[model samples]
Target: MNEAIKSVKLADMPDYELVKSGTGGCAGCPSPMGLRIVGKALGPNSIMVMTPSCAVASIGVMPKSCYDVPVLNVCFASAGASAAGVSMSLDAQLKSGELTGEKPTVFTWVGDGGTYDIGFQGISAAAERNDDFIHFCYNNEAYSNTGVQRSGATPKYATTTTTPAGKSAQKKNVPLLMLEQRVAYVATASLAYPQDFYRKVMKAKSIKGFKYIELHAPCGPGWKFASSDTVTLGRLAVKSGAWLLWEGEHGKLTLNTPTKPLAEGKMPLTELEDYLKAQGRFSHVMKSPQKDAVIDEMKAEIRREMDFMLGREKL
Candidate 1:
C-alpha cells in the first residue's frame, strides 16, 4: 500500500458512495456496510463478481443495480473461476493495447453457501492456483437466501430449517482453509469493524494474487435479531470470541486488536455463551436441559479450531 493509504484513518474514509440505497436486502441488514467499504476502497477501477446469493438482491435486479461499478453475476459455483477469468481477460486487454488504463480489480462477493459448500470447489481451485482476485464470503452461517437452510458454516447446535433440532457439525473455518491453500492474503472481518475491513481490502488490493476475507454477516431475519442492532451484535460476536478478527498476509497470521486479547487468554471463550443467547437461531440450544454443557462443548470446539491458527501466529 502507498504511504497515503497507510496514513488513512477512520475519519478519512471516502464520502463517495459506490453502493447506493434502496437495496432488496432484509431490513437492518449489515451486508451493505461491507459492500460499500469494498466499493470505496477499490474505487471506479474495479468489477464485482457474484453468485446467486442475498447480495444479488442487495445489488438489485439489474437495469437498476445498487453497485455503481460493473458486476458479473456468474453461476452458483463459479465465482472463483469467473473472477480469475475476468482478471486474466483484463490483463490480456491491457497487454494487447485494447485497454489503456490500469487493469481493473475483479472481486467475488459470495455468501457462506457459495463459499463453504456450493462453490467450494471453484474457490479451492482458485486458491490453489493463486488466482488474482479479492474474495469476500458473507457468512451468515446458513443458506439464508434460500430460506435459512443448514450450510456447512452453520455453527454446531444452531437451529435452522434443515436442522430444526440444531446443526450437528462445527463451522468450517474458510480463512484457515485459504491459508492452507497458501493464498496471498486472508482475513476474518465483521461489519462492526468497518475500518479494519477497509484496511484489509486496501492491503489486499495492493497485492496481486488470491486474497480472501470472511465477513461475519449477522443476518437480522436469519439470526433473529433486530436489524438496528446489527453492528452491536457483530461487535458482541467478536468480543465474545465467537468471531475473531485477524489478518493473514503472505501466509503469516496475526490476531488483530480485540481478538488478540481473547485468544491470548485475557478474556474467556465462555463469553460466547452470552453471544449465543443473543441469537434466535441458538434459542433451541439455550433452552435445552444442558445449556451450560452445550456452551462448554462449543467453547472447546472453537478453541480447538482457533488454536490451529493462533498457535501458528504465536510462532
Candidate 2:
C-alpha cells in the first residue's frame, strides 16, 4: 500500500495504512488503495456506509476488517439512504444530548454499478433532500465483482462483457447529474493523482450536505491491465479528457486543471491508445478497423467534453 501510494504521488503516511496483507482486496486492487487514502483523509471519526460491492468484499467479513473506521455494510441499493439515516441519527443524538464531542462524518461508498445504476434512486433522493454525508463512487468502470459487466458509468467504446467494442451507446455523465442536484460539493479524482484526490476528500469532510466525489479506480483483472499499470491508466484517462476533474458548488463550475493541450504536442489520444492496447480487454478493438473508428469517436467526444467544461472554443 505504501508503494502504491508513492506510485500515485501521494504521501506515505502512517494514517493510510489500514489495508494490510490478508485483506480481501485483490493481489493489487486500486479500490483498497483508494479506501486507505480516503479513510486517512476523513480520519478515524467517520462512519462508512458501504454497499454490496467490491468494497464490502475487499474489507472482508466482521472481526477481520480492513477499514480502521466503523463500517456499515448494507444492501447495494441502500448506500445513500443508509448514510442519510446515519447522519439523521447522529443529528438526533446531538440534539437530545445523548452524544457529546464531535459528530462522526458519514460516508456512502459504492462502485460505479452500485452508484450509477442500482443505487441511483436512493442517491437521487438523498441528494434532493441535501443529505448530510459524503457520497463517493469509486468507479472501476464496470460491475467488476460480477465479472466485468457493463454499467451506466462504463466508458463509450469500452469492451465489457455486456458491451463489446462495437456498442454504440455513450457513458453516462454522473458528475453532471449530481451537479444538477445543486449539491454542496461535486468533484472528480483519480488514483493516479492522490494529493489532488486526498485534498478533495479532505475538502468534502469539512463541508456539510451532499458532498459527492467520483473517484476513478482502475481494475487490473476487469480492465485486463497489469496491476502496475493502474496509475498509468488513471493518468491517461484524465489526459485523454475521458475523466474530467472539476468541482461544481451550487451552480458554479470550475475546471480544477486545464486539459492537457493537444496542440502543445500532447497527444492524449495516442497515449490513451497505448494505455488501452496494453490491456487484454481492449485487445480486440486494436485488431478491428471498425472498432478503431469507434475508439476515435470516443476520443473525439472526450476532447469535446473537455473543451465544453473548460469553456474553450475548440480542442
Candidate 3:
C-alpha cells in the first residue's frame, strides 16, 4: 500500500498512536517525539527491530512494551542483519499467500553508538545489498544509556565519561557515507521539526531498498541540559548551523526549508555560541584557554559540511 505520499503538514498529523505513553525515558527526552511521529507515519503495519539504546531502557523489557506494533529486540551489532532477515521472510510468506495482512514494513531503531561504530559493519553490508528495511539512528551523540561515554558521533569538545576533558576528533559523517553508498534514501532530521521528519519517514516507507534516517536527538542528562530546554536546544543547534535538515533519494538532494537558506548562505550562523553554551557537555571548552579557538573550529567544520553537502566543495 506504500506509494507517493501527500505532504503531511503539522496539522494533518495522523491520530494513530502506535507508541504509547508511560514509557521509560529521561525527562524531556527527544527520541519519544521521533517514536511517536514515526509510528504514526508508518501506521500499524510495521515491525521494528531494536538494538541496545535508550529506547531499550525507555520501552522496558519484552512483554512489557508500551509499543502497539510488533518489536523484536536484537543484539547491538545485528539490528541490520536481523531486520533484513525478517523482511525477507515476510516477503516469502506473502508471495506464497501464506501470510495475510497488509504488507509488513520492517525497520530498525538504533542509537549513534550502534550505527556509527559497532553496528556499522552489519548496517553497511545491508545497505550495500539494498536490503528492504529502514534504519533509524537516534543520535544523542554518545552512549548516553551506558554512562555517557563517547561514540563515533560525539561532536568535538564534548565532555563524556570517556572524554572528560573534551573530544579531539570530529563526528563521523554517516549520512554522507550512506549517500556515497548510493542507498535508496538518506535523510537527516531533528526533534524540533516533527513535520519535516514525519514527511520523510512517510516517504521512506514507500521506497524500496535501504532507507537511513538519522535523527538529531537532544540529550538532557547526557548533555547536562534540562529536559524542558530540549526543543529550544535543538532549534539553537540548527540556527547555529550545527545540525542540518535535508533528504536525498536516489542521489537527488533537496534541502528542506529553514535549513535551505542557511546552506545557501542567505542567513548568517549566529547562534553557535548559544547552542554550545546551553549544554553543559561543552562547558569545559567554553571556560578553557582555547574557547575562541574551539568555537572557531566548530564553525569551520559546520561550513565545510554545508558546503560539501551543497556540492560546492570536494570532500
Best by lDDT: 3
Candidate 2 lDDT, 111-198, residue by residue in tens: 9999999999999899999999999999998899878899898776678888765345677888888877789888889887888788
- Model 3 TM-score on a 0 to 1 scale: 0.95
Root-mean-square deviation of Cα positions for candidate 3 versus the true structure, in angstroms: 2.2
Q: Rank the candidates by TM-score, best first.
A: 3, 1, 2
lDDT of 1 by residue, 109-201 (tens): 999999999999999999888898999998988888889999999888888989989888777788888876778989898888888888888
Instruction: Give all candidates' CA lDDT scores.
Output: 0.84, 0.78, 0.87
Q: Candidate 2 — worst ten consecutive residues by lDDT sum?
A: 1-10
RMSD in angstroms, all models? 1.9, 4.5, 2.2
CA shift at 108, candidate 1, in angstroms?
0.6
**Candidate 2 residue pairs in backbone clash:** none
Q: TM-score of each candidate?
A: 0.95, 0.89, 0.95
Ranked by lDDT from best down, the candidates are 3, 1, 2
For model 1, the stretches where C-alpha displacement exceeds 4 angstroms are 1-7, 267-270
Q: Give the winner by TM-score: 2 or 3.
A: 3
The per-residue C-alpha lDDT of model 3 at residue 311 equals: 80
